[model samples]
Target: MSRIQLALNVDDLDSAVQFYSTLFQADPAKRKPGYANFAITDPPLKLVLIENPGHGGTLNHLGVEVESSPQVHAEIARLSQAGLFTEEQIATTCCFATQDKVWVTAPDAEPWEVYTVLSDSETFGTAPILATGEAVPDDEAIAVCCGAAENATAPGAPCCG
Candidate 1:
């Protein structure tokens, strides 16, 4: 099954967790130091809250989660055929999961990803290395991960907020 994913940036992890727990009537399915995710079946939503101080509390990125890597590739091909595929990440890890993803930009330059999670991981993935073999800085990586590139925001800019 596929589900809509909405990630949000919040200032306080604890407060956000409590609020969402109450609102959803359930605890987070996954929790970490600065992140929490509630996989709600009733609404079929994957709601993620990330603690990022200085970023205004707002929508971070939007995504569709599929069941398998093949589905991810199919979506990538479909989006590419439609001239929407902007970037692709294979076997990359983010948000405590290993995923294969393709990024597309909306009409307003908002980024959307169609992805499939492969497995859980203890840590967020390592720094992304560019094709030139140079490591992407953490700040830049965070921006890229959260779809800042589509809006032409600088690395570490308030893209989500």
Candidate 2:
């Protein structure tokens, strides 16, 4: 199934986890040192919480989590055909999982990604694609996931983890 993903930055992991668990009446699908994700069925939402202290309550990025890599590739085609700019990431690790995703920018500068998780990973990852649309180096994989401003020059075009 496909669901909308909303990634948020919170100040505290424990408190946010408790509140979201209560609000959604669901346990987190995955929880790590500074991260947590809830797969909520009723609303079909993927809520991701990243503990980024000063950015609390702020949105990290938006996305549509799909069922497979083909779905992600399909989106890349659809967006490209429509003339919307797209950055593609294949077999890249992010949010502690391997994923295939395509990124796009909204009119107001919000970053949105269409992705599918392929497998789990041991570490959190950054968008393999950098702001210049170049793949990030192996040593730089520890950067932020879905950084709000992925490209300092382009502003809203974000790199995803």
Candidate 3:
């Protein structure tokens, strides 16, 4: 099965966690210092919240969480065939998971990813390493995830905002 993933940047992690917990009637499936994720089955959604003090209370990114790595790769190929530019991160970490992801930008500049999680990681994985084992620099990795690099938007501007 696949799920729609909605990632949001919030000012307060604890508060957002509390509110979403009540709203969804389920506690987060994963929680860390600056992030929380809920694997909600009732509504078939993957909700993620990250605390970013500089955020504008807008969306961080959107994604499709598929069941397998092949699904991710297939989506990547499909997007490329449709002429959308994509950036692939294989075995890289993000949002506390080791994931294989392909990121693309919507027409409205919203960042979207097709990803499959391989394993859990201890930290919020921001520094995504390339398939060739080259690590993307900190600032550049952050820009890619935060919509600055792909969306052609100012740094810190919301991807969907």
Enumerate residue pairs that collide in model 2.
none
Q: Residue by residue across 96-136, what tens digits does model 3's lDDT show?
A: 77888888888887788888899998855565557999987
- Winner by TM-score between candidate 2 and candidate 1: 1
Clashing pairs in 3: none
Cα displacement (Å) at residue 53, model 3: 1.8
Q: What is the TM-score of candidate 2? A: 0.83
Q: Which stretches in model 3 have alpha-carbon errors above 4 Å? A: 54-56, 126-137, 144-161
Tell me which residue pairs clash in candidate 1: none
lDDT for each residue of candidate 1 in 1-161, tens digit (9 for 90 to 100)? 99998878788889999998999898999997778889888889988887867563766778898999999889878888887745888887777778888878788766788888888878655467799999988767656554445432334533321
Each candidate's root-mean-square deviation in Å? Answer: 2.8, 4.6, 3.7
TM values, all candidates: 0.87, 0.83, 0.83
Please give, for residues 1-161, the per-residue lDDT of candidate 2 as tens digits: 99999988788989999999999999999988788999999999999887877667877778999999889899999999999998787887778888888888899877788999999887777545667989765444443344323522122212233
1 or 2: which has the higher lDDT? 2
Off by over 4 Å in 2: 126-161
Please report how far candidate 1 places residue 103 from its true position, in Å: 0.8
The lDDT per prediction is 0.75, 0.76, 0.76
